[model samples]
Target chain A: MIDKVIIAEDQEFANLSVQKTMDDLKVKQYDYAFYCDDALAKIQLAQKKGEPYDLLITDLSFEDDGTAQKINDGIELIRAVRSIQPGILILILSGQYRPVDIHNLFENHEVDAYVRKARHDVQELKAAMDALSKGQRYYPRSLAQLIKRSNTYEFTEFDITIIRLLSEGYQQNKIPDYLKEHNIKPSSLSSIEKRLNQIREELGFANNQQLMVFCSNAGLL
Target chain B: MIDKVIIAEDQEFANLSVQKTMDDLKVKQYDYAFYCDDALAKIQLAQKKGEPYDLLITDLSFEDDGTAQKINDGIELIRAVRSIQPGILILILSGQYRPVDIHNLFENHEVDAYVRKARHDVQELKAAMDALSKGQRYYPRSLAQLIKRSNTYEFTEFDITIIRLLSEGYQQNKIPDYLKEHNIKPSSLSSIEKRLNQIREELGFANNQQLMVFCSNAGLL
Candidate 1:
């Protein structure tokens, strides 16, 4: 059960809105902080009291208040909180919508859920909280699509070698010769052609050019 | 010369920070609005008084204050202001970092410059203003990369048709037959092969599959 929650939002209205949503969900023990320093301090205090926070919700950007803060943004706060209480559920609440940055949050920080502060954010926040309570990770649909598209293809070493050769201006007919020179297996021209065709079909690419573009854009090559 | 300017930002502190930067620039007749509706009203009034704003700096997302607003977001405000005064220079000031969205602002919205609200935004905002004064457009380095990557290739109708056929599972050797059936010029097998190789070289793709992937991602086919 998610009984203890802490929200770190710089805006009073946003904080109240989130608190109201938590109240509607019947979450009894919840606290709010307007600064990253205060949020980190609360987490440390709760840990010392032998009752660490169950969930930590924070915004990625916080307005500068002229005072030096140890933790600057939500990502830093997540790192700090995770170090002190590694088991606490972390949910990011922000207006950021960059696909690369959002992908990094899940891949690097291990955030449990991401709720964008948009038009229907209250409802989305509720949904994110519910999913987290059930121990399921939640990603907004658009973000989920980005993750899915980038991760759809799993390239093997042979696939990478083929793509690398292609990107370096090697013709299909010449790739086998290079592979043979490198003592790589399946270096025959027919095998190289077949393997390239198979990869193209798997990726739904109509031609070799399209597959090259996909691999480059997806950072596979 | 930027004689008159207007800023639309919801946060008081952020507005003050922007205002302070403008003050440093010695901009004499600058105004501020906390709501998009009010900003639009100010623009209309300025247009009627024969003293239209020379530039507009606005944030994309505005927190709702319980009352319904017709001009709710910065994009809507931009459209409204453009309709009233088409020549006013528009510069977006926001925390949004989505490459696609930023690209759209340049391609569709006719924005003159975009300054992300980050740590060094004050300096960037000044640089943007300077560029605008000289009748030049300004795009942050990261946003510039997105624009460059997306615009690397310009596909002709013939090129697109070739890629489309390739994507439809037609082998390179068989594409000439389909092209001849369709009455496309240069339908010989060798000619088709040469055209494909040229395109792959132009786009820096090592193979036809990679070219296909690029075209697909670039929305060519």
Candidate 2:
């Protein structure tokens, strides 16, 4: 049933891999677009011609070669694609976003599958495509376990604000001044310090610097 | 005539690309290795069997996943292979290193061709292979111009010493004292300052911070 598809990716190397996989599966037709705008235009043209693409595979990042883009990123492009073609399946093939990022995509957007570009990308991509073609969502097992591990740290907006400030080189004592200027609650220096200490202790980090790095690595800020 | 090639690369996607290309070229036999040591072992085995690989295509960087490696990187692997089998052709296919890095490969190692992993990589790779098969070297025209531009600012070992110190967060004035302690020439504060000024002005950078970034970007530090 998944005969025709369009690959919305910028990298030529990734496109070749997809082309090889599509050939192996004997898919009748598959096309590629290097730019998000070009992909959108192609999809729209296909819809007008009454030959809609069965699935849309895309990467998260597209390099801006000084070209103006209406749809900037992968998530935005997904939303745009859904608005036009609600029936089309969406599969994200990327190495950019973290496991938590993928989970967010599942919750917010109706993403069908996520195949990470990694050491075993070729086989994983094949398995993902096969699962999607069978009307099943393909969430990678390793990613599912990683999501569970990363989801343990539940950061409220307030916690994120503190960690973000720490990562930006605002010392613990200076955070109160920044918070107070913006009328953020718990603007007192003592409260800020206590909250930071609690979060650091919960994460078992030695200090703010380590906590900052951990937050960054987890795509928190 | 191009047959029995070995692809030394970690990523499966790349292996798939090479496999497709080799299949198109009608190569008799092809093999792959995910690590430098493994690639060397394969080459050695083939040599023992008296049917050695015709060419070796390798990437510059390899990830170390806890296992101890005899040969760490691609250049080392190339050297080890050449020491055993000097008749084999060498092609450097990589996306990590800059054009200058490729020039170094030409100067030091007998690298036959360099194909960058970029957009239009499939065509570029095919062309490189076709040329290599005809006993001609393939250095991309784009890389040739880039090498010419990048080679303009030649950093002596001493100049690299100063820039490396700057990249390590040392102040400009503090460099002379470190150099003095190390018994380096031109250890006077004024001499260090003058030399840095000269280099920065030649590069048209406003300050040492910008100079540090430029040196880091140019692979000088």
Candidate 3:
């Protein structure tokens, strides 16, 4: 398992929650900083001491309380850390996750993973760690899908219904039952999976969740 | 001291967290619902059984996953519960909280308390419950202050310094030391308290936290 992480977040409660997750994951070598500058300083000092951090977890925005900071935001801090320690991994734990921002982070900035600060964020963070450990970039959807804006995609009524069901919290496997009950054509589980897979491939979305969000954004569901 | 309560939130983790708090607070008769419709049904059933709920803690947004719901949103659900069980206290636990929305909720919606979903929200929830027990509203600040929008308020450099400290994670008691170290005038603890108190009273914010946010919003800090 990976060790030696630095969490740079402003909210003490959120930071405490992250620490709890780190504890649960058996990571004991993590340190925390409330300011981006402080986080950068720690990373620099660690590098100088020849004991560099394996990962950097940060929040996108930090409240400015008139305390002057060399690095004011997460983006700059990420850049600073990247220039000094090019091999280090960086993960973002933030509440702000717009599709455009996700695209920018992966395509432009070298953010390794993004775990949105939500109710099950601990689990998400754990999953991200697992992926990052395997040299995989962890984000909500594939990078190709994230960059694919709400393109004018034609949706059949069946597509709309299935996407809406997924958005409503129905698991894909369970969706066959709902479709069968409604007497929708190709209601078999295999057929449903095939159709979903086709849609996902066509839209470049990785999963049903992404498909649901995109269709909903396009006012198709 | 609330005997029986119902929580209507979709996110299982947040629901679980609330249940944990209820347990910590020794609230034994609480129930959970994943949808606003289910919550209403539970409340209605309880009312029919002559075991009406004492409190309703709910979120403003519920995921619209294909399930048909009479109560589409939290506001409508709150109104529905208020009509059937007029005596029940209602508390909103939502992540989406803006100053204008807070004003509308207190002034027009008759919500008993509002606990924004954040880190340390459990403590905030406990504080809200204490206030609700005494028949006082629990919100970030008073209703009058919420309705008062950002007017042209002049701020001295000294006033900015203290609020800045508070925003930067420094407690009010710690401000005197920073002030004294910097050779700022009125560096005593009493003086610091008095100044913060004056600003809080003038702006009608209840605590330093709220004052810091307001001043920061107004670009004073």
DockQ of each: 0.18, 0.20, 0.04
> Where is model 3 more than 4 Å wrong at Cα?
A11-16, A33-38, A41-49, A63-72, A118-122, A142-147, A150-221, B11-16, B63-72, B118-122, B142-147, B150-221
Q: Write the per-residue lDDT of candidate 2 for residues A54-157, one digit (tens) a residue.
A: 99999876665467888767877888999999999998988544655666786675799888776678888889888988889998877778777766676778
Ranking by lDDT: 1, 2, 3
Candidate 3: TM-score? 0.58
iRMSD for every model: 9.1, 7.2, 20.7
Winner by lDDT between candidate 3 and candidate 1: 1
Report the number of the highest-TM-score candidate.
Answer: 2
Model 2: share of real contacts kept: 0.32
Per-residue error (Å), model 3, residue B74? 2.8
Residues B1-221, model 2: lDDT tens digits: 68899999876777778878888889899999888999999999999999999999887767665679888788889889999999899888776445445667766757989887665677888898999899999988877777767666666778878867755546667888899899998888787788888886777655554554445445554
* TM-score of each model, in listed order: 0.50, 0.67, 0.58
Docking class of 1: incorrect
Q: Compared with the true structure, what per-residue lDDT tens digits does model 1 show for residues B84-137?
A: 899999999877444444556776857999987654577788999999999999
In order of listing, the candidates' clash counts read 21, 0, 1
- Candidate 3 lDDT at A165 equals 70
Question: How close is candidate 3 at the interface, in terms of C-alpha RMSD after superposing the true interface residues?
Answer: 20.7
